[model samples]
Target: MVDIRPDWQLLIDGGKKDSDGDGQRAVVNPATGEEVATVQEGTAADVDHAVEAARNAFEEWSDTSSEERARRLYAIADRIDDHFDELAEIATLENGKPKNQSGNDVFTAVETFRYYAGATDKFYGDVVENSKDELKLKVFEPYGVVGVVIPWNWPPMHTADFISVALATGNTVVLKPAPQTPMSSIRMVELMLDVLPDGAVNVVPGGVEPGVALTNHEDVDMVAFTGHDVTGEAVMKSAAENINPVMLELGGKNAAIVFDDADLEKAVSGAILNAFYNSGQSCASIERLLLHEDIFDDFLAAFLPAIEELNVGEGMDPNSQVGPIIDEAQYDKIQSAIDGAVDGGAEIAAKAESPTDEHLAGGHWVPPTVLTNVDPSMPIMNEEVFGPVLSVTSFRNDDDAVEIANDVEYGLTGGIWTSNLERAHRVAARLETGMVGVNRPSFVSLGLPFGGYKRSGIGRKRDLTETMREYVRVKSIQIDHTDARYSLDLDLAEQRTY
Candidate 1:
């Protein structure tokens, strides 16, 4: 067993401060099934300190030119590249994702930063046409400080991407990583300190106390969060007290509609990958699959065996197709959801069996599961199940597919599979969602805006141009030249006809 107790983590305030204390949480390695380290947990007071540091730093950071901001961002991206291997190891150890997946996610996160870095110099507010004599202007300026609540499923990608965009837009940040996965995020903060200006970025990792404190901090100007709908709601409720602007990428009970004209093999492959990737913990994972009645049997024929043959093992194993769930709590949730579906009269197509092997038995591992004969109204279909479970239902035609697709209250994303281009557009347009994919399972993009419509979430992320807008408030500057040129006509005595 690897020794885990080490003086490893510290609260990153600006560029300094190792606020270690007795309050610590164990960092578990899901692959090897061991506790890697006991990281220090931050308190509400700590959040105050971090926010103060960021607020102070914003004074200088906000004044920086777009070019200078871009340069600093690129430098930070370079630092991330230098430490990619070490970061990936930390991510794999802490998050239990495959080593390759961890590495790729890190790479993607760096690329996201690099993209924003380049964008900072290129994009700025345009000059709107205003009346002559006096100059009327609009400027985009940074919010004082931003609070980011990072989720656990893809910690590095989500946190890094948000941090990059937040800083590029000239906003300082006080970030709180999820309690379950904080080491990877802390290491990211360590890397940031090497390049970022002092107090430009701060990280405090802990449980609900710190998160709640960070969100409700008086100094925090805006909130950017990625997580489940339930927690998203809580964040919004908290923000309402202050009327804080928020960008939320929340949960989804996404559906993948397969039309009869679609290629069965392609649709089946897309569904399997999207529904089960990241242990089905992805926000955009297609949990409810709506199949056309004509091709329903054929679709199941190919999909069932593919799921059954998926190799379930440790995330680090190169051959492992399905990895362990994040933790015990998530495992229990997955089990409960499956049981709930079964009780609702849904047929289990393939249930995940517990492992007998000693190595796999201790970790939170679950096999890929599938359920059919699902009703659209079932709780399992209605709710977001962030696990390796797929619930499928059948539709008669295109109209039926749209009805079933839009049936869910959560509308973050959905997919349509069809060879016909016209039908794909029509169906995709009909789905009341923030994003939808046709003939594709995944719609995550680095340039497009990502968010939900209804209970899933409000606001968006990743539209560098649009995201910058969220971080700024428009100030209207009215010229008095119009008043001089034309007298006020509010009263009959002051009225003038020109």
Candidate 2:
């Protein structure tokens, strides 16, 4: 096992390692269903301790110069680049993402650090001239200590999303990494400790207890969470008690719309890549496809054949295009989603063959599948499956496509594929999602804002400058140097002067 010490590890404190006296849990490899590592099953007490440490160090760290913070962030990025391969392998083994995707995820952390490094001073304030007598100066200041809770899909990238920018804006952190994939985050924080203060960043790896504790802690200034919608509700309630602000990134069931005049090849390629990437574990995955009635049959004919060509194998295999489900709960969830859809009259148009290798027998494997005849009201089309399952339906025109796409409770993202530039622009503006790609189904820009309307999330993420603002609070400092008389409705100034 990678982290075999039961008594030695359970919590990572600043630059020190300690045990919570709780216990240890085995980290299973999704590809082989084997124990590949072990991590501490930290308790609530550990979370409290971590938060205390962060609070203690917040003042000094936040007071440091922006240039000094930028220098330290760059050092962390350099360390990540030096050990990219090792971190990627650990992530692949635990998260069941293909090797290349794992590498990209790991590199994403490097990019995030470097991106925010240059943005340490980006959260600029403004000086407003209300009148010559009174001037207002607004400044952005960091929230003392931020509590971050991340999901298991993309640990490396999410670590950067929730932590890197928080640090850039000068907030200390207490991260509760996802239980299923905490090793990589723990490793990432280890690198941060090398360049940051002892209590500037901390990680407590465990199941639900640590997350609950971190969110509920009164000392935490802000909370950033990424996970299921149901769980997000609980976090919101917990933070309510302390009256702390929260940034919730609940997953979504997004849609991809294809028009009759669209380029079939491009639509098919985008659909496959987005639907099956990381076994559809991402919030941006297009869970449903809305095609125009005129081209429904033709699009399916091209898409079905492409879906059948997907390869499912070990995550570490260089040639493997797909990997196993993250765990048993998710495997069962996907299977149930598919079976329920079929029973409800949905037809399976295409299904890739399951892994035939005897070694992967115990792995949580789900075949890449395509479903048709699914009604808009069906749970498979409404609920976030978060699996390699895509449902198809047809729309009449641009208006019809926008209606169907906006019908769901989630407005995280959507795609509109068409050759007509007017329709692309027209329909894109009408969709309810926060971000959209005119011709690309699953396209995302690292520099643009990413979040959703409705239940998908609260607040935005990415674009270093904007995210820097999320971790800070704006303070208005107004100066009054005027001795001149001012217009007052109540005329109370004369009475006060007397």
**Best candidate per lDDT, number?**
2
Q: Write the per-residue lDDT of candidate 2 for residues 219-314, one digit (tens) a residue.
A: 999999999989989999999999999998887888999999999999899989888999888999999999999999999888999889898888
lDDT of 1 at 222: 92
Q: Where does candidate 2 clash, by residue pair?
A: none
**TM-score on alpha carbons, each prediction:** 0.94, 0.95
TM-score of 1: 0.94
Q: What local distance difference test score does each model get?
A: 0.81, 0.86
lDDT for each residue of candidate 1 in 1-498, tens digit (9 for 90 to 100)? 223346455455555454544588887866556787877788887888888889888988988888998888888888888888887777777887777778888898889888989888765665565656565667677777999998888888887778888898889998899877887777777777857778888888888888898778777999888887788888888876878888888888898988999999999999988888877888888898988889889999888988888877676677767678888888899889989989989988975454456766678877889999789888998888798999998998888888888888889898989999999888888998888988888566778887778877887777777766777767666455654544455576555675
Q: Which pairs clash (backbone N, Cα, C closer than 3 Å) in model 1?
A: 14-199
lDDT of 2: 0.86
Q: What is the clash count for each candidate, in the order shown?
A: 1, 0
Off-target runs (Cα >4 Å) in candidate 1 are: 1-5, 16-21, 351-356, 479-498
